[model samples]
Target: MGQGQQEQVATSLAGAVSEEISASLAPVDAELERRYPGDPGTRQPVHTVYVPGDAFAVDTIRSWGEKALTALDTHAPDAASFAAVLGLSDELAEPVHARVRAKLEHEPIEDLRVDFEDGYGPRPDVEEDETAARAARLIAEAYQNGTAAPYMGIRMKCMEAAVRDRGIRTLDVFLTGLMVAGGLPEGLVLTLPKVTYAEQVTAFARLLEAFEKTHGLDSGRLGFEIQIETSQSILATDGTATVARMIQAAEGRATGLHYGTFDYSACLGVSAAYQASDHPAADHAKAIMQVAAAGTGVRVSDGSTNVLPIGPTAKVHDAWRLHYGLTRRALARAYYQGWDMHPGHLPTRYAAVFAFYREGFEQAADRLARYANRAGGDVMDEPATAKALSGYLLRGLDCGALDIGEVARLTGLTRADLEGYAAPRRGDLTASTK
Candidate 1:
């Protein structure tokens, strides 16, 4: 109870804290430099890949959208699915955007997005205050909530010849609506649909860079997500490092690479009747994404599980649904965060996230504190001290158990190890391949 005793305890704890924080940090930096050798920011699988729900739900139309979305939620390959709910034109409904907005605000959407292409209806210029206000309302609602509002994104019409074949134009206006009316919410990641070539991404990024400058937003702050719908993006390019090459083409602007499964399978002449979520084409598409993200900052996400667990079998299918959710680890292995199509996938999303953090942060904290106390420069000894700590750093990363900064702070694992550690080395590859 005495002041002297209290002072000694406080001083002792503070010294311990100092020692702990110091020990792990030094080797963490050295290890990172040894492995990566360059910019850590540019490492593979940059952020988590966020999958939007609109591609699947939009076909059901805004009226039946919710029911369809809930079904996808139940059986999606992973948890935390991204959904695209667009704002309707003034002519369609007075506050047409409200329905879509409600789905995003209410549903378990990971990324809230909209379709802003001209044929998607409404020119950026003609929209009056009411339409703008409705659009703004949705954006504001998402932002104010801790939800990743819009994260601010727009899915522009496809640049692929296939989309043009459908007679869609006025793509330019989509960019304008997002920049001008949507007010370009911060941390915005644009979804460029049906990209057939790397040039499309470069062009779009350039357009965004111009807009960002004009609006006084930081140049290059706006990032991108690629829709792997076109056949060319998947096959035929820079063969081995297809994804890496694709990312290179993005000029470091690509944040995530998503599988447009339905369209992708369709592009390969796979019929909807025969096409299931596990089709070979879909598998190839995801494989490419994983390879591309290797050692990069980009994140790759698996596509949706098409079987909707909606009917009486929903109970029986829950097991399979949970099993399928493990695809999130596959994406995590690639260091990608979001996936396309399937808001129902949110559960798996959180599952992957929680599993990683559960051990990563806590274990990493303990290691760093221990290292700090020793005061010796040799943080890496052997058996108990070095390997045990390194095991946590490596295993935590491989299993999506820890993030880059955490291991980077402690055992000297490079950001690459943290980035590459999404899928820990598995002894049983045969059973684990999703």
Candidate 2:
């Protein structure tokens, strides 16, 4: 048959089986509905600093941010020193030096995570509950006194068979203690590391539900992040992508999926010395995660660089240079969130972030101005592009890259306009321009 005739015949036949097919596929449709990934959040922190849980204290985290500032002021006090630490060419650094300095001075750490996994490796059983208690007390105190970061959380051990008991016990104790002592704060996330299966995530969700009910909290008050640290998390035995399944299994409590660079690389048999965030295998896995989580409200984060900023001597300029490059690579991939291992990593983190946002500030501002004026000469300023430009400026403003006056001059919008801004309204653009 001719192609058109064949298609017409197929369509006619399809109508005959449509009702039966729909009935037969009802179960499949239900599965798909169950597997739907939820929304991706509007904003995500740029970095999550990991402090070993055993050694965790709110005062210490606060102090680390303070110490990072002092270190920046002491070591990279001037533009020359700042340029040297980040290894920026004098010409490249000259423009952003002031912005970097201001960011370091104001907000050194964007997020902090108290890690109980690798960072707190195999503590004594007795010590675990005490540590959990301490963490709970400090968490409550930070909330009351306003000493915490904008985002903070605790990374429990993996949910695999090996550490499942320890992991759940630690979480239960920490949470029970947190509630009894005072209350959990907003923006708190529980980190479940080394997730290898969807069942584990579903179980964690159940745990969150139980915790909520027991503590008289909201149903989804206790959200958690899953770590994509193993090959199994990226692909299943049947060779299908497991990320979607993992997100489905979270049942709406999964806040983000974090990449554990060293563990993920080691799982792929990458050499210890060569394992890095930009590894091809790591990149592939993160790309899969990005695709799976795209528009699903589940944020995707890149893994950390294993290299520490500490050395035998106190000289850290070289170390900061390395850290900055690593962070820059993550930013290049659009993975704003990553793991921070040391206090020294703080300066380089902000330096790289501000540099990334500042580099495109001028172009974005000009594009947004023209687009907002409803004049897109030689530039395709669709609603999507305008929204992206507004988002860039919003993030820049949040990170202290540009202040209110700079935003007004660049985009011709007041702070309030941008704060509740979604996209350029069709009518607003037409009416104002007309």
lDDT of 1 by residue, 1-434 (tens): 76657543334366778778878697985654443232233322212223222232222222233544454444432222221111112332222123323443353343545554322543343442233333444454455554443244455556556454221223344344555554556645566777777777777677667766877877667678787776788766555544555677776677777776677887889988766445777767778777666445565655545544345534425633442354534534443344433333333343444444443455554554454344344343322343234444554454343456755566454644433432323222123211
lDDT of 2 by residue, 1-434 (tens): 76656453334475659889989999986665455433332457888888888778656765776777767776677777787667776755765677655655555566777777888989888998788778877877777777767777788888888888998998988888778867787757789999999999999999889989987897888888889999999999999999889988998888899998988899999998889887899889999999998656688898787666664424577778778887888877778778787777787887787787877888888887887677666677665566667777877777776677987987888866664444444333333322
TM-score of 1: 0.54
Clash count for candidate 1 is 42
Kindly report which residue pairs in candidate 2 clash with one another.
38-296, 39-296, 39-297, 40-296, 40-297
Error of 1 at 342 (Å): 5.1
| TM-scores, each model vs. reference | 0.54, 0.84
State each model's CA lDDT, in order.
0.49, 0.78
